[model samples]
Target: MPRLVAKGRSHFPFLALELLTFPPAHRSDFWSPICLQVSAAAFQPAARSSLLEPWCRSSAEPETRGPGPRAMEQQHLASSSALRDTEEPASCSGVKEEVTSCSFNSPLFQQEDKNGITYRIPALLYVPPTHTFLAFAEKRSTSRDVDSLHLVLRRGLRTGHSVQWGPMESVMEATLPGHRSMNPCPVWDQKRGYVYLFFICVQNHVTECHQIVLGRNAARLCLICSQDAGCSWSEVRDLTEEVAGSEMKHWATFAVGPGHGIQLQSGRLIIPAYAYYFSHRLFCFPCKARPHSLMIYSDDFGVTWHHGSPIQNLVTVECQVAEVTRTAGHPVLYCSARTPNRRRAEALSSDCGEYFEAQSLSQQLCEPPHGCQGSVVSFRPLMIPNRSQNVRDKSAPSVQQSPLLDGLLKPEEVAGAPSETWLLYSHPTNKKRRVDLGIYLNQNPLEAACWSHPWILHYGPSGYSDLAAVGDEGLFGCLFECGTNQECEQIVFRLFTDQEILSYVQKD
Candidate 1:
């Protein structure tokens, strides 16, 4: 018999059920009686035997060949245990009639808000002196005074408790011309200490039937700077003509074309921008003759750019690119986007963002089926040991074993393993729209480890709008809303560890 332990008093009726199994020889032992503190009027003697018999069954055969029955029972319990200690009325009729087992094998911490819309769109992440900055668009309804475009900062976690970085600043106002709607794509440049915000703004529009008819004005990429470590931001400046009028049109309303800017090892900055055309006139094909994702290179930062056509024979929109530095001495470019088939897909490139392979990896991610923005970042190794040997140990092995590794030593060890790539996108799974964070070990960039189970960072009635990682650890992400209502009024910036992300799926 198993024992029941109650830690505190319960104001409402509580049900305690325990299932235990013993060796066949010990089946004759009487289980300990569970103490009940119910009033005499509320107790019924006849119902006790039926409820207790299920808990008393110890004859079920354990599966020794595979996972034992206890392990299986624990899995069932963890997945089904939704009991909340509240005063809400219990709906016994809706509860499933099956019993679940539980185990304390895995642990995960998930924080979710029930009222906000979530987005998987990509944003620019930067860590300045006092705060972590995340820049993205918050799409709002057309009826509102202005479409919501924002740049939010949360306080960096340096000491004890973390706090919001800025006062949750908003950059969407009427003072700026061509600031009609929110732009979903933003990129940060730490070397130059600036953030390049790209968006498709509308001008020369007429109002029709209570709707503001928008025309394709020139797309603008604005550079905003914070000289005082993100405390005070400078006025936005136009980079369209400065970069030689490389502004593109909107392919899809949700598609913020080409927002990734990667500084390659060759000191050349490769920035991707797409050419798209949108018409509210509603033809047979809503999006027509849009050039696929395009790339442009700059030798002198953003002063000037050399344009390149879309890469040949690849079909994707709103693509993002990041450089992956393997533990080995090779660098690769990883690109992720929404496929033409409306699936979240990814591809790789050996040459610096100049050309990409036609094929994508086998494991498909749960991104928005339709076009949505996403971002990818390469994480640097946490610890790098010194290579200089002392004069006395010059002839010793180049690498020293950690003292913490008592007897766990292998003869042959793999060196220079590539750093893991974290892919953040919105995908629909288990009938719930969630933002799935997947980590791919870059042993072979084409095929990720089969054990790479994606975990849910946030889940609720809403989906993810955008994601950006702050600082060297690349743990926390600032997310945005996906809907057009500007429903994400309260900006939420969360800090999470990789261990916490993996624990969500491993919980027993």
Candidate 2:
């Protein structure tokens, strides 16, 4: 049996059930004032398991897959009806939030009469200062990475509970003369008010496997900055030699994010990345390659950056970072990544992203066959809506009223701030394939087992995704690839509120 552990703390009263089968495990931490132990059985679906039987049958047949992008014409759709009906209602029905979704990119979208264009690898960044949401993707002639031509973007503004997004445009300036641009990773500097878009430019038609086989690095690290949200961008700057330095000699290839990065409370910027390095044999003949997730960070704002050491033990790739604060002073950098182990691998860094300590596997967050890129963002835990706000009870207090939340608090929360840091993660929920996109919550982000069972976001043909915390009013956004027969047919955006998330995780 798999074991799910949540170490540290005194009272884990409101602890959520993990989506895995294992006995509850708890460890004590001196700095943390709350600890939780809950059974995995609480999350097991009841007789309603049959409601998901159609998925397995449909997923096996291409012709019987979900309806295509055209069926999603009605943008204002409710959260998965299948879920709402099959699962027991977790909260009062009155304040339940409606999920607003829209197809931002599809073959149906005409650009100068162009058709059959495939967009993939989504990255979303939310600028709090301007209340702006920037959605980035690669413009591909075909679904293959080698066919990636350039980067494209869409800007949105938070309007009430929904978002009003503008038109899609290509980041024409984010390219080199003789290369193709892929992976549109965006990192916003909150303190400096600058939007840094980092990506890799590969020599035309050159694939990653080609570089790994020859032990050569064909991808160049490049970035473009914007001062006015994403309306305009500066020229691309090649940071390969500057940041990677002599390290490139041993790396077969490397890539940054393909998702958003984070800025810590200390004004430091960290971009999650990974590199495939050569494992040599005698005479260094036939170099073998292995992937490891690392970080590229800057302490003096975005002026200069240095790469950190990769996780040495297990192979990991395509990652995102978030800073979690404990009850005792000081913050820990949390790194979540895609791994071949079929389970999400997490690592922590006490000294920012320079180096990572112990690595743990999140048994509940299982991945597909080869693994898929996921996104994670950290935010202050929103106060659970009170009974006056149509909620079920008033006995459950906010993070402020309970000692159970001490371990989850941020540095500011320790200084009498109102809320603690919580994490929201988005990825494909299926273990057999990349379908059924879902979102998982971690109220106590410092612990690996604190993750709640995923609340399925899209029920079919879903892959590569990015999550952004929309403003601070308990709103979030997800941009992912989904379609009827295949995931690459359309890039869809969904807006959901904290109430919807909390209701699902706290349900009986």
Candidate 3:
């Protein structure tokens, strides 16, 4: 581990990561803390990077795929094959008090926008090729989900020192006569080198309860694409039939994840979503019908989109999927979703999001009385050598990978692979309320017992979050809702190195 002794703390300032704690009154450290506690995994990043050569290909230059620049009106798209983020890294807006300082490192999207309103349900995306992070959210006038809301986005330019956020941009360039855009879910297809921003449009006057009672699918499936990262985007593609096919006639309405999507290594693009099931007969208002977690997948590099079957016997909503393992022989996909039973639900799929195995609840992930959305991302374990991939992060801590460790031995010899995959989940760690937004890591993702103590992201009232692994640089960024006194006074963004996360190890 890279030792940040009592004095060497200057080199590491991201531990605003450490200051992210639950109700200080609930801890003994609040009164007489002899020393600050940090997660062991926090320090594991440098070591992990040095040991595992991150297989993530984004750290390198982004290559141009299929087509050249897609010409669009009012869209200043750069070269299709080039990367762009024209800004310098700057420090976070200053806050004086200790409790509020945690947000000083990164704050991509805050409550105060051009129009004074709140921004909630953050969705973060890390495109390896362009090395850009697109932070998307619902610009709401009030905290209410159905209130006056529009979609706004900010692009984070990686300028070596810090993330420089561009001016907020409006996503709904085209206006429908009576529709409102909600649920901003994006999926990146490495093969086609495209980013699909999938969302749904519901009539402004029609809410979820209104649709259920009406027993009709008022939600329209729509999408916009960008060939050169997020710099420019196509006008918009309304795919109500192409995506849902005949399923639109079903009963209730559905929504895409308010977070990010995944492209399985097998070349399938999957977006976590849920829809209410109904028939021609309308269900009563306080609808007893449940929303089941499902996937909207694409096969031909997003040329065609299809919805996957929901997890049987489980009711889930607002979830994210990640490829836990993607080497030659054994491949597994992990899905984490919010459940109504006051807990998070998870399922594994061998196929590319078409069908999943059984689902189960996580004892560690506690949902509030009302369910909330959470985010998940997968990456190479910073430490332990995965016997399979035969590669590790090259810049982690102090590990010197000799030929033996890298599996470059005699011609015919084989190496051992990790039995499972590793995952990082972000949610509010508070048991009863949506407070103390923290992140948990599982070195052995398949085994719930292996989840590490949460590395707190922000204290106080916090809601909906999205996690992104920053290419192969042994770093990651979290875009979440946090405030000093309320859950979402602001939507904050913070970038963390593996070393800083180790300090968040639970105090056993």
Candidate 4:
């Protein structure tokens, strides 16, 4: 559900609102954010707020005959709303004053008018124990990914619905030394109380094309550790020689996730990555082609790392992984990656990401031409529907649903250490355009036909996204690239419940 904007813009200078649009001429009238700290009283309720008006009213309005469609809820969004963020969200440079946003989630990364950054990449990491969110982006001075971009970070405090974010700072600045540090893939070691941030450092002014044509892997795998939940970070550690070993000779280019990484239940730390392979012909000439998704894993909680066998045959890039129990009672590492042929490629690894048996292309999930990165998350709160419930729900045209429960759980899996696996994926909903972002739900990961989603987080320009579960609760928060007319304008965050996702079913 959408939260109401707080009053006192002058008193709370830390908030940079992406509210109802004004006009182009008055772009300077947009008051920038002040401090990161916000009082609890500053938060308002969503019901009586006028933040989202005219535009939001049509999409989320309710009918007199019934409550509302599960996909869209009707609410009279007011114009007098304010967005609360401590730092500059993946902010767009210019926005029309008439533009307004009304959704369950708001922008997390907004462009700063004072700063010259126009485009960047987004990555989100959530600490379940502390309810803290770490937002990472590759900051840039212009739209292109030249050798100038540096890694920047912002932290968010989630206490209930209100999230007070801190100011942005350059977290990793290898670019200052002439090399560019790109692609942030962060993973939390909940048991060890450590977070590992991974990235690749490319030589100064050397493009991926240059590395491919030379048939050499010039990118260096680097990592940094955080102990106090990102309050401080250790020095960068280069692991290219140890982890890549002789494999770098056959690699044109490689990098870890441009998103969040996961620590499996077995205490294994796996960072999703991919690389373009360099093929040497019989005449001793090297050639390059499609990339393959692979895993960089550390079995002893990031003490040491290794490169897993890449998923073959299917060309895949930028992907995410989750542990699921679709095969008998055993847990398998499942990965979903972006492809050029229009469908996302999925694979399962039995050896903790060491090797993968790639599944066929999923017709339900399509990959855009340029390929967009998607996010995957695993939580026990979700359950695959029983055989009978799926049939019954499909037959019924209209049915009332609990405001708190979706078809994610069945009676048998409701109690105990519920293990029936379900995976949630977030990506652009359309194949031809990067407009809508839908959350894909798959109960039977082995069966592509069993995949579906009931929630569309945003109906605007949305590109890449990362998903995180807040606490032990079924609540989820999404950090993604979104804008009014273009995907690169901003990076937004959204939180929703199972009920909100399944409320499409009529309420009793």
Candidate 5:
């Protein structure tokens, strides 16, 4: 049975008394009226803007007027303001962005034309915060400047702050009291509260050989400090005479090696030293076996010293050792070298700072054709959590594809493990080997399967010096020399954060 109902009002005739009523339509037609009613109700407010004034003037409602010229102008002004806000400049909108992003820093190389010949070498330790002190040998044709050694103190602007440091003071003048000319290498010792400067004084020149022109007659280690926060250093005390037979030519390079002279668990002080032979005559050829690497230990800080057995690996000169505890096992001393081969060499020492293994780890990557100097840091592996249950299932061997595996009930599952090792060094060029930073990662030492292609951190039209890790502040700082020519008038130290490295990885 079908159901029907009355819809509209019922009317009665006045005179004849007749009644009229409207009946509902079919259910299919019923929706038509309802849809029309809903659409009209929705559009009433929108239509009222245009129709309201006409309705108000024509009807008994109070008279209302449409917008005047002034109101229309104000409305247009408001619209323009809204559009302007939408198109605001990016810098003013508080969106952080990089000024320039690249993997390498540049000015890849530089050479200075002083006197008759061109002498272009990478400027060492020019950056401000990381480069506390820098020392290098410079030769001039004229006697006025002469063949002199120069040292510079680093200074620059922090990202959000301003600070200035004075020019680097001359240490060779005061330290080499008797000799007027000397070549020096300076290193700062935070633990000993002094800067240790090493230099070789010319004993006498050999006119016959011409090779032994700069034979080291005397080697002196000075303990220097400045009261004005390293601005002006006081006179260096002669610490060389304190060592036994200190007057004799020891022929060594002093470095603050592994442990940074921290009081050990055994209550002993460990300082690392390496012995090497340098000659102006042998400058073009490779180094001989005479120069070797050695370690020195002091029980009462620098007050007393005992020389340890020399490391058997004497293949490289300018060696550097870093104390690191990478895995859970034990802390090991890692050594790196800038050898004559134009490649970096590494070795590990198991014994407690006394002796190291003979075999070396070679990074076969191409180094700049000239002399190189840099450092390495061993960072812990960064682990990412796996949340999928199918990870193990996906790692299983494909039984369907292999006949040998199909016979077995279950296949073996191999999970990829995570491990990271990083190496940083200066990249050199053919004409002038400017200092630049390169990073490489590996799970195993010198193993291609575990290694990554080298990535450049900062290289530009300028060169970077040595890099230092400020663990306390989580910053990797570098000294950079920005000059059109090799002679850099202004040097600055710049700081980059750990987040920058992570961001680089993400982009790659």
Candidate 6:
């Protein structure tokens, strides 16, 4: 069954409302999204040409102002098709050359009913087995955090190079009476075949500031699982008492990743979270509080949960976890988090999410002012057979190779081959404002210095984002908050290839 709401007006920058609908859901098609009365808006005539026009492209001219090496390289990138197509040697600083991006100009969650309902905080989960992508966001009464009401979802099926997206559906089971559900963090468990959606249920409209000021924990850890690849969900389970234990009393408030979580190689589910530590109290009133990123993990699938130690002596929040491991090497759990500092912070865990070590700030990954939520996803580097190995195999059969593997050399053939754990990060490239959503790559996850310059994804105002590895090793899908005038006006989804990431990412 599908629920439909009346069409509502949109706020600034949008013109006409387009009521998009899908046929009612059939019980047999589990992947079909239960259409809700969701309205997609089109830009005003004076605002832009068409909603389908791409915001940016690699082959398009770079928007330049003044002269500099970076600007010159951008000019070169724009002038040369060989460079744009990666047929010739591209300069290391030609990072502005955009990748061939397919922007679904239509938002998954738009500010439908601008006077009331809005969407924010996007989280993405890709189920490899089904080649399905689940996009989640906080359906709010307004853009404000306290107005968060429901968690909505849309399922996209991978069809060749493009995705066929279903209509939006609200996760009614993820909510509790008198409480608002926020932060939709979804993770897939291949072992038990469950898609766990983790979020915080805050009572009424109590803001995080309210909990921080009074030094009281108002948020509760809750989760709902879908056994049928997000088609249906189980009842909400409150894991606050069992997971946080007495730790909740020692702090103000906490929230799980406003992004996606990770599953370790050993079948452990890691949910990134942060809490305000109640450092000390004076006159029986708590005053000092600091944020630290921590983890909630489950070893026996999603049956039981436990909290791990937070990043010691560092102020970090809104984090994501990635399990990094070299080929035939031990696994290393890496956590990157948002911080108040101008740069993001990193912590490593050798024994899974039980403990974190080597906490430090990533000078290369700059964060805007007070910081913004970013996404980190790790994947194996694209590898090809060595020439000698190819010669050895020539006698067997001649098989067609993918274009992506054409230019790539084998690890044994090339010097400085890509490391085992290559990480893809998404955040705003601007240091002052949340604009110009950029995607960064790190060939060597263990070395903070190994991060390359970002490939700007979206040019205008952008905020919170989530990245999920899709298709091959280098292909990724980004679900983020972006708008023409302000962030969070709508949640957009785009896909990027490894070749695009490598072509646009410049190493210093």
Tell me, by lDDT, which candidate is best: 6
Q: Which is the better candidate, 1 or 4, if ranked by TM-score? A: 4
Per-residue lDDT of candidate 4, residues 1-508 (tens digit): 1122433432221122233444567445432221111212232111100111100001111111221343133111211223543343322222211212324555555655323564356778888666678878776564334433678877766666555565566876334365777788899999898978898887765545434333445688999998866767898889999998987767867778879999887888999998877555312223433478899998888889998988887877788999876433457688888775678787777677888854557656786554567898876554344443331124333332211112332323332322356677899887775567788665445332445643577666567788887655667777887655455566766766655554532221
* Residue 424 displacement in candidate 6 (angstroms): 0.3
lDDT of 1 by residue, 1-508 (tens): 4443322322111222223444566434533222122212223211101111111101111101222454345334334433222222212122221111121111111112322222222344544443444434333322121222333232222221222222233444212574543343444555666544554443323111011112233344555545444445666655555553433333322123323466666666666554433433321122233325555566665556555445444445556666765544446666665443445556555566666644342333444333334455555434432323111122334444322112322313223342344344333232212222233222123223222344433232222334444445635453432111122222233445544544443341
**Backbone collision count in every prediction?**
23, 7, 28, 24, 18, 1
Ranking by TM-score: 2, 6, 4, 3, 1, 5
Runs of candidate 4 with Cα error greater than 4 angstroms are: 1-103, 112-116, 173-176, 281-285, 326-328, 382-387, 391-419, 505-508
lDDT of 1 at 236: 61
Error of 1 at 217 (Å): 5.5
Assess every candidate by TM-score. 0.55, 0.74, 0.71, 0.73, 0.52, 0.73
- Candidate 3 residue-wise lDDT at 316: 73
Candidate 2 lDDT at 142 equals 57
* Cα RMSD (angstroms) for every candidate in the order listed: 23.8, 15.9, 19.2, 17.6, 36.4, 17.9
Off by over 4 Å in 6: 1-106, 113-115, 384-418, 471-473, 506-508
- Tell me the TM-score of model 1: 0.55
- CA displacement after TM-score superposition, residue 212 of candidate 2 (Å): 1.1
- Where is model 3 poorest over a 10-residue stretch in terms of lDDT? 51-60
- Residue-level lDDT for 339 in candidate 4: 72
Put down candidate 2 lDDT per residue, 306-420, tens digits, no spaces: 9999987777878898987765667878888887668988877777988786676765679776577889988875584442232122333333222222333343644443226
Better of 1 and 5 by TM-score: 1
Q: What value does the lDDT take at residue 145 in candidate 1?
A: 16
Over 1-508, each residue of candidate 5 has an lDDT whose tens digit, in order, gives 2322223321100001111332345545654464344234222221101121111001111112233454344234323322112221222223332221111222211223323322111122222343332323322122111122333232221232211222223344344444323323333444554443333332222110111112232344444444322445665555555542442343322322211222233444444444443322222221221334555555654456565555565444344554544323345555565443455556555555666654343534343332344444444434322322111123333222222113221223111222233334333222234333344433333222222344453332222244544433445544433332222322233345555554444445
